[model samples]
Target chain A: MKKLLLATCFLMAGSGTLFAQKYMTRTGKISFNATAVHSPEKIDAINNEVANILDAKTGDIVFQVLVKSFKFERELMQEHFNENYMESDKYPKAEFKGNVANVGEVNFSKDGTYNVKVSGKLTIHGVSNDVTVPGTITVKGNALSAKAKFSVVLKDYKIEVASMVADKLAKEATITLESDLTQK
Target chain B: MRKSLLLSVLSLGFVTVSFAQTDSLMNMLNSGAPVKNEPVAATFKATRIIDGSSVENLGAGVLDFRISHRFGDLSQGSQNFFGLDNATTRIGLDYGITKWLMVGLGHSTFNKEDDGFLKIKLLKQKKTGMPITLSYAGSVSVQTTPAPTLPTGDTWLFSNRLYYTNQVLIARKFNDWLSLQLMPTIVHYNLVDSSKFSNNTVAIGIGGRIKVSKRIAITGEYYYRATNADMTYNGQKTYNALSLGIDIETGGHVFQLMFTNSQGLTDRTFIGQTTDSWGKGALHFGFNISRVFTVVKPREFRDTKATSW
Candidate 1:
């Protein structure tokens, strides 16, 4: 009877509250397909990373990007990409300010797959836009998986392409996100 | 006549004193004059593009002071410091010449090697219909090993890099204090030494910024260079690395902490030759604390406008 009580106490102590989970990956590719006849039908990694993703309860979701810290291979492309395209030095960073579901039970012990819409505002290149993305949260014992897919238009913000290679770029871009969460 | 002779001699003494002061300044500091050059700022990290839009050329001065440190280097021999086999720790000044042109000279504290580089932005990036920012950056570096291994007569080493980055906002201001920038990058290397340098490699990097206050922010990024970057040398298996870092901003000063799989921080050495997982090891732990100083005031003769152009 005493052993049974101890087990029950341990269960109660572990009940409630979603664990703080963080996921990270930099090898995930953010590639661009450019069709320049002389440039060949080639693809390139844009020196991008989803450094970290932190999830928790109480309606708090935060994200950050170090504007000046991206890397690439080609000296030519890297120079133009930074000096001409992204004004990283001046702005230095872009961030996401929003909340996860505040009222949800934030079930920590359940073993099931749940679907929810993650809504937040994304600011980049000095412009702000609102985004509502549909994603899934999976709970398997103590681990969680958060996944989402979304699309954005560059024109929504006021970023203008220079006249030289105006016709060589894309207008619409797709962003896909997948992350695994662990106990914080 | 005696009075005139004394006046001339005093004037000559003053001229000599002024010349000595100017020469000493030239030898002690990178920028002999305190006037900071405001050069064009174009960086290849794609997230910067997605966050602020395309960068234009401009001259801006860099900080006069750089506080840099060293942890340890990978197993590469000590001769490769700065264009040799490897290079570690670089701290120096940068001057922006045009809105799009920047030049800098830095020294590696580990090997007492020095290098100078020029960066240029090719195109003014514009937002796509969907808020996509694209840009390109190119730089050339001249690094010299403290001692040359290839005949003392050969003392100079050169490295070049070209990169492209694209950044986008996945979720913006869910409220007022947060935003996210998705950045991607590609770099190219030309003119690498055969002994320790790898062929041009492909890598990916991502970064983001979180704001806790109006003027303060937290920033981080990660980089993964492909293993294909390594070519066979004397029959050995080599691999590139994955690096991650963060930056804290307060006014004009930005403090950065970096954990890299490769210890060489210069463009040629780190990107060209990487060993050991900075991700798993303790030596790759590095930090760069940098500050940006702007030249605000000009005194009389220092201001060219004071003279007739």
Candidate 2:
């Protein structure tokens, strides 16, 4: 009976650690800007319903966003972004699956901000590309917050800019992401 | 026995820990199903599905300048240059007052008719659960044509020149490629030509849009008047209005080219007073041009320079 009790306690502790290894948030914020230098209209959009998950043990990070969720300054832009650029109906989601390169340097239990390097496969508009981004992760109690900004060539994702709006839209888009997550 | 039990427990814990490490990061989020009750969007590309009001409404603060042109009967052939010689045009401005409400004003050259309408969205369709979007549209058209000279010396009141049309539009977007709508409509004329015919006409309109590509679609609309089916207007027999069009979207503009049996543009004209019959080859080649301008920036992007996040 003593041995059985010890075994059960050991199993419980192992599962508890596994549970604490992951952090997640459904309401992550991600925004992007693709306006050209002399464009008349500002071409920017934001999505607040991004889903993000970070596994502290494995340093794995994942982000998934619905293409239709991105809201633009002009409703027409929003429609064009979905129907023309992203083809939201055909490919409804943009996803990133990657890992933190410096996971061993930061302590997940400590409350501090740590700069990290992340590499991932980003899939947009039914196309996937490998990307690396530099970011910061702040650990506070059981909560973790992350912020990152990166630029991607629109052509890399098969997003085409029509000739009529080529001067208005930049070839590269700057994306900024911020997420607050709690242990799950 | 105790040692064996300990060994099994240790192995079980090791197995689970290894399993956790191998679980792909993307799969973790996928375990939880996606969001629900999200409102569906872009059910129809433009505000009109040919001749009737579609279930779509302009976003708040957007203004659309619409021009509709219809030529005379195509059966007129070379003498009339395939109906190009005669044309009726309506120029309108539609403004979105709120997310759910919109208003429009226009003047048509057909009868020197001036028209205004109000459309309100009552229920929006959802991506998963909700099946249909419902909207109500009410319009008034007044003909400014000279009042007829009455033999009895009766003065024509201003109300006598007015006509009203009320419609309930129910639409469903089944997929990315197909969408359909049904409009149950009522048109009331303040004055009628004959006492035997009722002043109010009841109609049912059916419309659809089929996407041919990302920027092009095929649209069709038909209105069947149940009341006064045999009524005549301007010495012509009335017939059901039928229109078939192709919509081409180029950024901020939507160009619609169509062949319709009705020359009147407003709801009262097209739904209640369409007298040209398709069987007689009285099809009019028409087109509608819609251009939108963003009058107000979205609240989210109003402070574009500020880092609100």
Candidate 3:
């Protein structure tokens, strides 16, 4: 009888019972920083992105990348980023479908913070790698906030760090994303 | 293409239309359909809504300074001077046409006494969330005559060029800083010399705009002929030359500096009269200055905004 009850309970908590949520923001920001000086200062280009979240189920979330939204402030950096680092002209969109585990009465409508894990295939610069990033999402009624920090090896993307400026660009890039999301 | 023009018209039927130089140049030139309340490209974004040549908001206007110096004057030196290259310089002005157009007027101390033209954005900005910029530009002016040569027959000459360009932003948020743009063009010359190189021809150009930071952007563009553009005389073809240039934008102005194998910004002059060799191309340093004018100078700009430009 106990086994029968557990089986019935599992069926009740299937994907059908999983609530979906959405968040959006135009001002979402994704930034990166690299250090290279006049002496032995050959460094690779660094870039980042902050996209919006679509209808995401409790167990998994999704985002649509603003392909042309990527920015590079330096001429050399911008050029190298395109020709060598991220072949944006070929693969323009990046998607992430990750899950957030562990939840107990987590009110997305209430003003509170929740620690979560983001795991998904991040496609960028013509390569996609699975990633599990530690992040947080906060909510205050309809107001939403999200933040995450992660690092990736540029080589994973087939990015050929130019031998000329590789020193400036660390093989490992530190990335950060922060945004104030609004629920429709 | 009429299709592009029609598309622009169609877009305007829906809403409306931007400039600056490097990332600024790319962003302003590329951003196409204005998504309501979207963020302006990185820099030189106006504060007002620009609708079909009408302004609902007036953003900041800048004063740009450019000094361009070509290596030689064929007129001043003649056949002897034609082959003997040196450098000449000039300054000019450019203003945003709309969100998608930019117009420019400039003068030089060499062959082109004064010249002006207009450029229209074709595609949308890559970083501002749009991809590609297809623009069209047509310019006309008389080639200058060095002293003693006198302003003879070709004084009021005219030349028109139609050019198309596309810009794409790579990776990074102000970090990677990269972009590549290509231009295909057709130049029509009012006066074509009997020489083989003097005829109007369809050429190709390639340019790159890179931003090193929020305040400075570096850009380089070159024009080359797909067919033989050299004057073939007595079994000799004057080598086809190419132009190389760089631009920097700051505050409200952009400064362009360059070294071109060809001194002429026109089709005929650069194609035929080039004195530079394959590897021994002449170094011509030059620049252009751009300034903005308003039917009604912003209330605050009336007095203090007078640019040193």
Candidate 4:
């Protein structure tokens, strides 16, 4: 009976460790800036309700953002972005699924910061593209945080801007992401 | 030894189940779960579909300046240059107070009418569940035309020249290319020509848009007068209003070219006072031009003084 109890405790400890590798966050922040070089037009939006999950065991990461949740500095610009550019009604969410290229270099059990390369397929406006971006992952005891800055060309995602206002918008928009996650 | 073996088997089963749970977690992460109850948008591109009000509303703090022109009936022939020579115009400004609330004022050359209206959206269709959108609109109009002849002792009362309309608009977007709407409307005119004509009328309007291209749509609207006798002018029977148009959406403007059997633009006149018949070739060519301007800066840009981007 004592041997059975010891075996059961051992299995419980192993299962707990397996579940601790998954980290999740619901309140991640994502922002984008598109400032035209020649014109005075500046378009910027922020979306704070981003959900992301990371599996440290397999080095898999996933991100989801509701396109309509993005708020712009100008209400009219927001409307145009959703109705004309993003078509949020038809494609409501933008998602990414990728993996950490160098998962062996970082130790999730230790308190440290590691710069990593993440490669994934990002789907935006019903179009998917393979993307690789450099990001930093920070571990502080039980908490994990990640941040990245990247730029994407609008034409690559089939987002067409009319020539009338093409000068007012940048061809490439700079995007920044930050997330503070807790182990689940 | 047998008891220890059974315990070992149980521990192995628990470990296997826990490992399987991780696979399930990965599967859940891979499948993108759809977000629920997001409100559907852009069911109709413009707030007004042809001659009738659409289910759409302007964004908050936005102003819409609109000009509507209706030429004389095509049956007028070349003498009137196919209705090109005679034109009745209406100029209006609509303002959005909220996402679902709007107010507007308009002046029309027909009957020299001055009109104002308030529209409020009560419900919106959501992607997760809600199937239709509902809105309530109310309008008040006053005829400003001077009476041609008046008896010495008789006086014209301002209240008698006033007209009111109450309507409920229900709309549904069936798909990306098609949308339909129904409006149950009631119009009241305080004074009429005689007891022969009713003071109040009920109408049901059906309208739809079929997208033929990315930037153009074929639109039509018909209003059926369910109650009241038709008003006659020179022994001709007036018909219910019917309009067919094409909507072209430019970057910042929506231009609608229509052929309608009604000469008036206000709800009181268009809904209850149409005097032209389509079968008799009384269709009038008209166009509506809409332009929107942002009157108030957004909350983020309101306090910022940095102009150089």
Question: Best candidate, TM-score-wise?
Answer: 2
**lDDT of model 4 at position A124:** 93
Candidate 4 TM-score to native: 0.86
lDDT of 2: 0.89
Model 1 C-alpha lDDT versus the unseen true structure: 0.44
Candidate 2 chain A least-lDDT 10 residues? A1-10
* Cα lDDT tens digits for candidate 4, A107-135: 98899999999998888999999999999
Better of 3 and 4 by lDDT: 4
> Which candidate, 3 or 4, would have the higher DockQ against the true structure?
4
lDDT per model vs. reference: 0.44, 0.89, 0.47, 0.84
- Measured over the true interface residues after superposition, the C-alpha RMSD of each candidate is 31.7, 4.6, 20.5, 4.6
lDDT score of residue A155 within candidate 4: 93
In candidate 1, stretches whose alpha carbon ends up further than 4 angstroms from where it belongs are A1-184, B1-65, B73-88, B110-113, B121-133, B146-198, B212-216, B232-239, B296-309
Candidate 4 local lDDT, B1-309, one digit each (tens): 887887879877876755543335445654645445766777777888788899899888889999999999999999999999988899999999998999999999998999999999999998767899999999999989886577899888889779999999999989878999999999998887667888888899999999886668899999998987475533566689999999887656789999999988888888888888899999899999988776665664566564432
Tens-digit lDDT track of model 1 for B26-123 = 23222222332222222222212111222322233322344544456443435434223433566767555554566656676533445555556444
- B155, model 3: CA deviation in Å? 14
DockQ of each: 0.01, 0.43, 0.03, 0.37
Q: What level of docking quality does candidate 2 show? A: acceptable
Candidate 3 per-residue C-alpha lDDT over A1-184 given as tens digits, one digit per residue, 9 for 90 to 100: 5644554455444422332244555466665544334323322222233445533334445443544455433222343354334554456555555555543435675788888777777776757798988888887787777788888787887766555455466677676777777763
lDDT of 3 by residue, B1-309 (tens): 655565556445333211111232123223432353232233221110010011111222322233444546334445546534555555555555354555556666556456665555454444465544344555555555543333667443223222221212121123245545444555555444454454456656554546665334565545466654654522544555554444454323345555555565443345444555536534454454333333333332354433322
